[model samples]
Target chain A: MKTVLIFEPLDFSAKVIATLTEHGFEVSLNKDNISIREALEKYSLIYMRLGVKIDAKLLDECNSIKCRFILIPATGIDHVDEQACYKHQIQIISFKNKKELLKDIRATAELTMALTLTLLRNIIPAIESTKSGIWNRDLFRGRDIFGKKVGIIGYGRLGSIVSNYFHTFGAIVQVYEKNAVELPSHFERASSINDIFLNNEIITLHVDYQESNIQLINSSNLMLATKQPVFINTSRGQLVNEADLLVALENKVIGGAAIDVVNEELGFNPKNPLVAYANHHSNLIITPHIGGCTIDSSHKTEEIITNELLDLIKNEV
Target chain B: MKTVLIFEPLDFSAKVIATLTEHGFEVSLNKDNISIREALEKYSLIYMRLGVKIDAKLLDECNSIKCRFILIPATGIDHVDEQACYKHQIQIISFKNKKELLKDIRATAELTMALTLTLLRNIIPAIESTKSGIWNRDLFRGRDIFGKKVGIIGYGRLGSIVSNYFHTFGAIVQVYEKNAVELPSHFERASSINDIFLNNEIITLHVDYQESNIQLINSSNLMLATKQPVFINTSRGQLVNEADLLVALENKVIGGAAIDVVNEELGFNPKNPLVAYANHHSNLIITPHIGGCTIDSSHKTEEIITNELLDLIKNEV
Candidate 1:
């Protein structure tokens, strides 16, 4: 029997396990996060999520290279050591560039709108105030999304979905993308990045993470935001300069920000300026990278990845 | 000279004041919330919002009725003493049934969507958790609105707008209204109130508040919510029975609730069960009746009302 070890089996559906078992694969569940070395010695195939990082050092510790397949049920492969896996002749399977499979994966786009709505409506403070038995509506006066000028940084899948949502709410959406393409008649194509920052009332980032675009929203582009637009980042933490964002928020250079990712996201860093600032001020709202943390999205992604893995194993047999 | 006393002049814009001044109508702002008797004794016209209550007792308290007009820049006239105004021939001018003037007044609808997004995304607790230096995304796993069935009660202006927003977010929308009307091809017309509560995963209320329909969402109808749907109320507080909602929430009869209005809105009542429950539990979220509170909405309503008032006064002169 072909043996497979699933790290972080909490969210893995029973249907996937049953399907694997039916196909003559003995699946071992890793509930307590056992050592990778032990797992490598036991199973030839491994499945993991973003929470568990597969680095070079961890791979080096495993003397016996029994693991030949690493299945990741996600689009991004940053959590896995791709170069190390390539050298070890281990194939990594993921949902990267699977357009048809990802057409309905809209949790991230939904969360982007959620963050924008919460910040624009002052929902957090307003609810807190009501919880404290105070009924002062004046203190939590917020701007309406209707008739506002919104700029989307990337015209990708999530970006287009979010911009369409804003457009449905009567907002004027302007999109900036590297790839030149025709857009809907209502949405304007911005000339440059500065045009998005300078002209719009709210700006959101949706570009993919790349080494060349690290710290994409630094002081230079942020300074051109004359409208004091509310900044939103649901893309990647590395895309923004944390120190520059902190300063921009403190000086009121931007209206406000609602972020789903941060630079110091792996561990609790006491000196994280954004988290510290969010604690004291209402101008900033942060979530712990939950842009795609919906149960429906998880189930769909898991089902697709597990079926694809089954297909690969069947071919090998 | 016609003298007008604005009871709650805090939100009264300078443009409205200047326009009133331009029309030769003397505007006196009552910033301190002066006595109703004093205001009635001096001014020939009174302008107020929802904060101030005009009742029969207040009308009787004034020995002589000098105020001839009560101008309200809103659709609801429940705050004013209509019977007393009629007896004294004091005309109560409001935007009631003025569809043209209210075409773009969409603050309440925007707030409805905001509250829905916040509750569905678990954004309030997620932000609080992140602020406490926790990065566990699994702890705050929320349902996506993309494929959820959302039932909207009352297909009025605000209700239709909110339903459209949810539909745009990829939600299945079902609407229930009193009058038989033609709907769009995508929207499903719910057979009855029970159809809305029984079949949907998320239900929202947007019915107009009337004496005949007080306590509309009582325990009887709430019991039919088999899906434990998230209940949203952005309409009048009196439309829902607060005591019953508290019971439903405590027993988990409903998934959760996000309410912007409450029964006891005027005074700080310690016994408000919803507010008390919201303080300790995450299932309920409350806001201080801020549905119609937005700078843009306020400006538009004020401008339209002020212009109409000027026309009336000019014709009288």
Candidate 2:
């Protein structure tokens, strides 16, 4: 049996572990904070999470090792060194490549809606005040999402799902996607990004992160906003300029913001501008990149990855 | 011109006030904390809000005075003294009788959905922790509302609207309404309240407050919640027994609860068990009764009530 190195606390279900064991893999769950070098020499297969960054230096360490396959139990491959893996003759397997595993992307879209609703309704202050033994409902008189104009930055699976939700809630949804696709009858297509910012009362970003897309929502683009809109970003953090967002919030350029991902999310940096701004402002809601982190989505992803790994092992044998 | 006494800060829009003034009513906007006796004797018409209790004593005072009509600028007339109004020949006019005015009941329904989503996603704690500069995404792994069984206690206007929202989110909506009306094709009718409690992952109350409906969600009925569902209430606070709800939270009989209304909401009672419990427990989220308090809803209701009041004045002339 091939020895498989499992990273501790990766949110993989017991069923996933059992499936690997049943498939005749000697799964050694590692708890010690040892270097990637030690694990590469001992095991031919490594199972890790997205939080464990596999950079170029770590990939270089796998040059003279028994390790051949690196499996990530997430949809994002941003943390992993793809070029280094190819150079080292090592194969990278992630849920990102498996389209079937990504069927439950609604979890991310739902979180976007939840955060958006929380911002619009002033729910955080309302709850905080109630907890402090205050019954001042008048202070929390919020604006209704009904008949509000919502601008979506992407029209992919997740963006379309979110657009449908807002539309169902009586929000007029407008999309500013690069690709022209057949949208639902209710959703209007924005002519440009400026059209989305100028007209929409609420704007949410769901575009994929790329090198060119870095800091896409900078100060100049944010200044295009005409209506005091509540901004939401459940997508990649690098897509937004954190400093510009903070400035917009301080100047009241935007009505509010709900950010699930931040630029410095990998580490808990207390001095992160978005984090510091959110600490002081009740209107800015920050969640630590848990948009896709739902029990159902996690379990489904685990099942797909586990099955895919078993198939890969069989093909290799 | 009939002298109409306006209550201070009743969320009535400026347009509503202008409509009354234009219609030849001498609108006296009062600010001093004067007695109902002064209001009855000085003014022919009294305009009040939901917070002001118009009991038998106030009605008796109107009997000896020029006051002819008691106008409430809201849907619920539970606070007004109906029998005393009849004896004193004081006409009780409210937005409750105006169907056109109630078109924007979506605000309350939207609040209900917001609270429900907040509970399911553990958003309160997520925000609290994030504000404290913590970026622990694993701690906020929420469950998806999709494919979850949601039990709605009423099938009236607000309840049906909420039901549609949950159903659109891919939740199986089972409703328990006393009167069987034509329901949407997607909704499943629960034979009894017990069915709702026994087989649902989420439960929300939308019943009107009445004599027989007091403490509708008592300990016994709450204990029947086999799924440990997240309970939500944006309706009348008197409909729930706060002590029973607190017990449910402490015992983990239910998954969690998000309450916008409580039985003792008329005043801020720090000793209220629900408030006290929420202070310590993150699972329980409390918002002080702001269900129908959206800016859009308030303005729309005000417009409708103002038009209705004008029609009434024209009829009297």
Model 2 chain B: ten consecutive residues of lowest lDDT: B96-105
Q: Provide the clash count, candidate 2.
A: 0
Model 2: residue A14 alpha-carbon error in angstroms: 2.3
Best by TM-score: 1
Instruction: Give the TM-score comparing model 2 with the true structure, all chains together.
Output: 0.94
Model 1, A1-317: lDDT tens per residue? Answer: 78989877767778888888887889989976787777766788888777767778888887778888888877767878889987777889998677467878888998888888889889999998888878888877788888999999998788888989999989999999988777899999999888999999999998887787899999888878898899999988999998998888888888899999987666658568888999999989999888888888888888888888877867987
- RMSD values for the candidates in order, in angstroms, are 1.8, 2.3
TM-score of chain B of 1: 0.95
Can you tell me which runs of candidate 1 are displaced by over 4 Å?
A: A315-317, B314-317
lDDT, candidate 2, residue A9? Answer: 48
lDDT per residue for candidate 2 within B1-317, as digits (tens), equals: 78988764556577877877887888877778566778877888887766667778876655367788877767667878788777877787776645455755578888888888787778888887887888887888888988899999998778888898898888999999999688888889999887898999999998877788999888888888888999999888889888888887788888899988877766669778887788888788889888878888877776776677678867877
